[model samples]
Target: MIQVTPSIAIDESELEESFVRASGPGGQHVNKVSSAVQLKFDIRRSPSLPNDVAVRLMKLAGSRLTQDGVIVIVAQAQRSQKRNREEARERLLELIRAAAVRPQTRRPTKPTKASKERRLVSKDKRASIKAGRSKPGAD
Candidate 1:
């Protein structure tokens, strides 16, 4: 089980991992060993994530989330499969933990009276400057 937070925990069975050959400067080892780890998590079916958290996860994931709502994360930075796998798990936990947070509701605020007055004053000044540019004969 992967615990993202105190309340959020995902079953290890739900995560699908795939190993593939990594590309980089590992010489013969990179050419032979399958070190890259692709971690796939289905956000739509995960019991650990709340409905709102799932929605936000989908939004935050963007193109990474498929039409079926599976979030795919690839970790290949490390040469060893174990390190790559750990990196992928860490990334998934971070993403899930971030999703678990509820964003503070933004209170809609209007411009202050002084600010509004300043804006109007600026606009008036600009308008007056433009007005002065008019030809004397054109009135």
Candidate 2:
């Protein structure tokens, strides 16, 4: 089980990883070994996540989430498959942990009177500048 947050723990079975050949630094070994890890997690179907967290996870996943609501994360930074696999798992945990936090509600506010006045004053000054640029009798 992987602990994302204090309250969220995902079973190891929930994660699926597939290996593929990576494209860097390994030279001849790179062509023969599958070092890249593709980690997939079904956020929509996960029983471990709360509904709110799941919703936020989907939003956070963005392009990473597939049509079926599976999040696909590819890790190829490391030359070893084990490191890449660990990297992918860490990324998934990080993403889930981020989603666990609730976003602060935005409180709408009106512009301050001083700010409004300053804006109007700037507009008036601009208008005057433009008016001054015109020919004296060209109205």
Candidate 3:
């Protein structure tokens, strides 16, 4: 089980992991070993997460999320498969932990009287500057 927060714990069975050959800087070893880890979690079907957290997780996933609501995180920076796997799991846990927090709602506010007056004053100042640029009463 992965403990995301005090209230949220995800079962290990909920995650799916696959390994693929890593690309980039490693010489011959990179071609032979499957070091990249692709971690998948089904946010839509998970019983562990609350509805609100699940919704936020889907939104936070952005491009990595599939149409089926599965979030796919790819970790390949490490050369060892174990490290890559751990990295992927850590990322997923962090994402879930972030989603667990309730977002603060924004309170709408009207412009302050001082701010409105300042805006009008600036506009009037600009108008006066432009007025000065006009030709002086037909010379």
Question: Candidate 3, residues 32-69: lDDT per residue as tens digits?
Answer: 99999999999988999999999999998999999999
What's model 3's overall lDDT? 0.93
In model 2, which runs have C-alpha deviations exceeding 4 angstroms?
A: none
Instruction: Return the lDDT, model 1, position 60.
Output: 86
Q: Could you tell which candidate, 1 or 2, scores higher by TM-score? A: 2
Candidates in order have lDDT scores of: 0.91, 0.95, 0.93
Best by lDDT: 2
* TM-scores for all predictions: 0.88, 0.89, 0.89
Tens-digit lDDT string for candidate 1 (1-139): 7778999889999999999998976789998899999999999998878899999888888878889999898998898999999999998888888888999999999999999999999999999999999999997
Q: TM-score of predicted model 1?
A: 0.88
Off by over 4 Å in 1: none
RMSD of each: 1.6, 1.6, 1.9
State the lDDT of candidate 2 residue by residue for 1-110, as single tens digits.
88888899999999999999999888899999999999999988899999999999999999999999999999998999999999999999999999999999999999
Question: lDDT score, residue 131, model 1?
Answer: 94
